[model samples]
Target: MGLSGESQAAYHYTTTRCEWEFYIIVTHTSGPTGRRVLSDKHKERRVGDSREMVELITSNPSALGSLVTCDESWIYCYDPETKRQSSQWKQFDFPQTQKGQAEPELFKSGRWHLHQDNAPVHSSILVTNYLTEMGVKAVPHPPYSPDLVPCNFWLFLKLKENLRGSRFEDIEEMKEAVTRVLDIFTLEDYEGACKKWLECYNKCTEVGGSYCKGN
Candidate 1:
């Protein structure tokens, strides 16, 4: 069947009909998770939430004054001055630490709201109860939606850029370096990040929540 779609398939498939078996396997078994794929329902939630955020900000420019975001990530660390210069990446995945449990004093002193994602840790009853007890609010984030998180679009980008190629002895030294970098950012920088958040929400709503990341 030279004229057939099956016959005209890629050479790899033609060689062994291997892709057909792969397709069957894929259909039968769940695939490994890597990148998140947003569903239509997620898009709906993102759009609605984004609109609310825009309106909230529009009605009150200071609405995001206490907003926070997910700022955790793997950072490469090394010290150029020592033999420990071999790259050692530190993975910060402590759910409790991320939810401010580690900084209970700060959260207790003042109300805090987080634009946190719907990860299992963030949504856990423990963290929720803690926030409620601390008089802090948790903004509802659409599932699988990171584009709306300001930290993703702004803070981390700038933070990593400033940290790139810089070396530090250990996690403590790296943490200090990160703090130093953050200290240099002016109020305008923070305001700009907030503005970018608003822009992202606007874009999300504009595109019916189907917008691309980093837009």
Candidate 2:
């Protein structure tokens, strides 16, 4: 979707947050009509580890064929209805390569691709080369396009708000709490969020502004 110049200031401000120091990845499945039907979320542990990322993708083939979207802290691959991992999941990285190897079948399935902003890790040579070799296409997202990613504008804020003023006994306990929250996210919630996302996108497009609200 395109925005008019009149809203450039708001749009630019929204996009700037896409470059924040940290963020998380979230995925949702969409129907043929472009409505989100499912969701699977993941927290990014670190950056610039192509090998680890390849493993993550291979392990979670159920997310394949979903519209994978993320903010600065997370990256997700997900599908709405399919519960089983794709048989082609094993081919994303080559098996014998030293750096990282993906299975050839994973790319051939044409089910997985990266939709990311131009963050340093997303644009790293290692990441790019590995994706290239794996034949996974990266979506051409404009710099600072937070409107294109739902997490920045909606979910993350809600998630943080839910965690506000809460204390955890330790990192492990915090992690468990976060996991429980994420696990309880029903498909209906994801679809509702996507509907809101489409509304925001339309509003931004109509006003020529970025779709993000300042934090």
Candidate 3:
């Protein structure tokens, strides 16, 4: 809900490796803070795209667990969730994997989709071309659809809630606060996130993609 500062700008990129593995990338930027109002066109697209996601998840159930998604959020000096993030990592490790499954490398060339928001930083022609050249399948995220992303609907909110009201002396202090919150997350936390992710998607489809709570 609320952040701790207004002097610094923080952007977070969250990559969910599996049902229980994920990490965050933080970037600092200079900008304003506020909510984004989606146009009618964007709202329609959110409904259609989320419905497609619902179909994918319903048929496979473990579909998202198999795919790695990336999205950025704006962390104002006070709020650290919005649209300042990127997707350019080589590989990552997971805290845990599904039983009987080998650890997954999200970028095994065509094994995972690179889900990015339509932020200017993410949508640059260079970025698009790079993804195309690398044969990376891009997962489409409708604008103003954080309700469908786990980090937005769950992880970021958890961080804000835990880190709220604390005063960070510097960047290092803020980092420590964030890491503290992350380290305390357990298997149940991540599993719960996956459940919430799908439930939100279902609600999105039900509401015709307007706005759903608890997503």
Candidate 4:
């Protein structure tokens, strides 16, 4: 299976009645074909302003963890000192929801193969070394191929269908709504995605890795 992270920009009304930029990190988890949803993780925080995100990311994109959902009720808290790529991968070790808890962190062992996209952070020497240390194997991804990315073809579109034209009063409200969307996905839904992914993959391979013209 592949692990990928994408950023989404959303707007929310603030206490002062001004709109602010809410940046979220959407982690897509899917089967090997990049179809169907194994699970989805979201990390978000309100930036000082829309422009501030540019500066913040320029300085250190990893700092986005500091804004990650801190409430125990949420899956993962962005801990600057303790959190990093390792912790993100570790979340898969726990059951999605167990004993009425959401994303409870109980360490369990299992074999999970991961393919990460070529983001600067994902490809960095630090991240690669950490993944090697943690025994996670990296799947090679072709450069300049957005269509080959599963999230672009399926996951994000489905998410947009739910979130399009919706408005949130605050970041928390938006988080809750997104959480519901992620948790409500059914196994069959993911299975369908997996099937679609294979179909797309075969088409791409048939063309010798050139972009396919059809949906």
lDDT of each: 0.56, 0.42, 0.60, 0.39
Clashing pairs in 1: none
lDDT score, candidate 4, position 86: 33
Please provide TM-scores, in order, for all candidate models, with all chains considered together.
Answer: 0.66, 0.49, 0.68, 0.51
Evaluation by lDDT, superior candidate among 2 and 4: 2
- Best prediction by TM-score: 3
**Can you give the lDDT of residue 53 in candidate 3?**
72
- Write one digit per residue (lDDT tens) for candidate 1, span 60-145: 75577655555334445631222342355544332211211133333444644566777665678888898788767667778777
**Tens digit of per-residue lDDT, candidate 4, span 1-215:** 13233322222211111111122342222222322221211001111122333344346643322221100011112212223433443222222422233321211222333443455646788878998998763434544444544455665556555554445554455566565554555656655654564465556545544556654
Q: For candidate 3, what is the TM-score?
A: 0.68
Model 1, position 127, has a per-residue lDDT of: 81
Better of 3 and 4 by TM-score: 3
RMSD to truth, every model: 17.6, 18.7, 9.6, 19.2
Can you tell me which runs of candidate 4 are displaced by over 4 Å? 1-107
Q: Which stretches of candidate 3 lie over 4 Å from their true place?
A: 1-39, 74-104, 213-215
Candidate 2 residue lDDT tens string, 126-208? 88898899877664454445555656666665554444444554434444444444444455666666556456544544444
- Error (Å) of candidate 4 at residue 197 is 1.7
Clashes of 4: 5
**Clashing residue pairs found in predicted model 3:** 3-78, 5-77, 5-78, 73-82, 74-81, 74-82, 74-83, 75-79, 75-80, 76-79
